[model samples]
Target: MAGRKKTFHGVSVGILMVKTGFRRLPGDVGHAGTWDFPVQYRVVEGATPDKMMALESSGLLDEFKAAALDLVAGGVDGIATTCGFLALYQRELTAACGVPVASSSLLQVPLAHRLIAPDKRVGILTFSRESLHASHLEAVGVAADTPVEGMPADSVFVTAIKSGDTVPRFEAMRAEVLQAAERLLGSHPDVGAIVSECANMTPFSADIAERFGIPVFDGVSLINWFQAGLRPRRYPQA
Candidate 1:
């Protein structure tokens, strides 16, 4: 392969981060420690969690595109975002960046749907159930009727993320996430798998999976799969 024009090398993914002050735990996509492979990050100023929830009117698509282009110039093989709601811009970002872009973990929903039993369905746990509309799911090839559950509006998980709490209550946040999962499973007993729509929820994916006895897919899972394709491992010949 021909060498590409890049300021740096060896980074396979460039993560476009929303500007926020929330504490990013180890499993969060924004945290460097969450990834086994090195990743580059570019923060899109003014892209807050609230604005991202209503991305269609956020007027930040251009800003996100510009940031992604900048990451490509800096040498990332692909693009990703810290917000799952960015799935709305999947087509635009992929076109603008001229590289593979996994804009949201929700992109895995269609595949998750296929991985489960014919009668079973994939459920979503999001930051705001109301904000996640049909267009967002349709953009990613997910069924508009897919079951979805959100953290309570006043729950610690939603509050900390929206307020950008620098000192988040980890246990409280975990509990809220688990409760949301429980609600999802309770309402839709046929949910064979789950896709976490908030990047911050990645930390509790294991707990959700273990507690609910269902497969949980989140930002980490999406990015790891994205990275594998960008830099597949090689086996030495015997």
Candidate 2:
């Protein structure tokens, strides 16, 4: 690409991360070990989880756009963010970055909806149900009536994240995530697939699918797909 000032090569995915000190587990987007391929990360300082949940009114769009453009300048072929709530800035970030941008895991909702039976729905497990408004879903073409469930404000998952707990109890966090998934599935029996809206929830995605016996989509899936397109594998001549 044009205007690339990269000092490195081969890493095509650039992750725009929200500033946090919490320990990122293997499946979390902020964790480097989560991907089979290489990736570069840029942290937007001061862009915390609470601000992301209120992104529409948070006035951080320009900051996010600037960070995305910086990544593009540094030579990443595509851009993605750590928080699914960044769905509100999808269009803006894509335009500013001048490269393919997967701003949120919620981008998979429309596809998840298509993957399931017509009578079934795509359920969303988010960081905050009260904050995931129709505009956020609509920004990414998800229907306004899509089913959603959020982790309880007082749950271990939320508290640890908000406090940036460096030594979070994985088992407790996993249980909290499972409970949220259960609420989403139980209240909406027609939910045939789940879209996890919190990038941090990816560690428990397998548990969700195995427990519910349904497909689970998250930031990892979206970024993996994004990376594939940016740097497709080549094979030896047959």
Best by lDDT: 1
Q: Look at candidate 2 and tell me the lDDT of residue 25.
A: 94
Where does candidate 2 stray beyond 4 Å?
A: 2-5
Question: lDDT tens digits, residues 60-158, model 2?
Answer: 988888888888887889999899988999888887878899999999998988888999999999999999999999999999999999989998898
Clashes of 1: 0
Model 1's alpha-carbon lDDT is 0.92
Kindly provide the TM-score of model 1 when superposed on the true structure, using C-alpha atoms: 0.98
Q: For this target, which candidate reaches the highest TM-score against the unseen true structure?
A: 1
The deviation in Å at residue 129 for candidate 2 is 0.5
How much RMSD separates candidate 1 from the native structure?
0.9
**Sequence-dependent TM-score of model 2:** 0.97
Instruction: Please give the CA lDDT of all the candidate structures.
Output: 0.92, 0.91
Q: Show how many residue pairs clash in every candidate, following the order shown.
A: 0, 0
Q: Each prediction's Cα RMSD?
A: 0.9, 1.2
